[model samples]
Target: MSKKALYIRHKAQPGKREEVKRIWEKYARAYIEDADGQIAYVYGFDDTDPDAIVAYQFYDGEAGKEDFVKQPWYPDYERETAALLAGPSEFRTITPQWIKGGAA
Candidate 1:
């Protein structure tokens, strides 16, 4: 089966870029240990805007993506970070058309 990917674009509230990065790092560590369906998680700050951050998570497949959303920590993560966000996060689910070099 083909892998699935989730893309998230987040804008941090004023002066919250560092906090957002720290929280995301904590979340990534937890996800690495416990996310069964996740293949990888990548995150970074936007090039043009330091307050904007982007994250991507690769899954085994669409079902894996579904399973991820159902995980107990999902809602908690969303709620915990919601207050630090300048607005709602932009989310997108994508199918990999081509991949090269790296494992992703």
Candidate 2:
């Protein structure tokens, strides 16, 4: 299957969800907003898990994701995020064969 979307579920260390959100807002938000081929990007806290942050991104194509790690702010964002995370994130690749509207 061809993948055009990504979902990341990350659980922050207890009481560190705010730090994780700040890191994304300070770094990743601008990059995603300006990135080429990015169709949509959104993130928020999990309804049942106060320590969890979930992110969903829709790309125009697979090539759209190539620059994520290459961005200048990526290192700082990654380091800060990793420090606050309870553990490794869960990545879910999606095949967008039935997309209908913009992401929330």
Candidate 3:
């Protein structure tokens, strides 16, 4: 089973979605290209609500993730984004223990 960390944001306003997307994009790219042991970082918006932004981050291990978050760029971005964000963003770390048969 692989481990993943999910970050969910239920946007408070429609206008700020673009800015949020840009921020996520920047961070996601950095995670994949610069950070060590990061498998992938993907994000998207809710189809129905549109106000929701979700990020799925796959890591080689938990340690890799811990190091990634502690990087200087990450905290700087977080601080700058605090006010631009609507509310508290929800965070979860998940381990994929099982998979149903399916094709995408």
TM-scores, all models, native as reference: 0.80, 0.89, 0.74
Give the winner by TM-score.
2
- Cα RMSD to the true fold for all candidates: 2.5, 3.1, 3.8
Query: Tens-digit lDDT track for model 2 on 1-104?
Result: 14388899999999999989999999988888898777788898999999999999888766767678788888999999999998999998787767666432
Which one wins on lDDT?
2
The TM-score-based order of candidates, best leading, equals: 2, 1, 3
Q: Summing lDDT over every window of 10 consecutive residues in candidate 1, give the lowest-scoring window.
A: 24-33
> Least lDDT summed over 10 consecutive residues: which range in candidate 2?
95-104
Off by over 4 Å in 3: 10-12, 99-104
**Clash totals for all candidate models:** 0, 0, 0
The residue-by-residue lDDT of candidate 1 on 31-100, one tens digit each, is 6557777777788889899789998988887776676567677686677788899998999988887767
Of 1 and 3, which scores higher on TM-score?
Answer: 1
Candidates arranged by lDDT, highest first? 2, 1, 3
CA-RMSD of model 3:
3.8
Report the CA-based lDDT of candidate 2 relative to the real structure.
Answer: 0.85
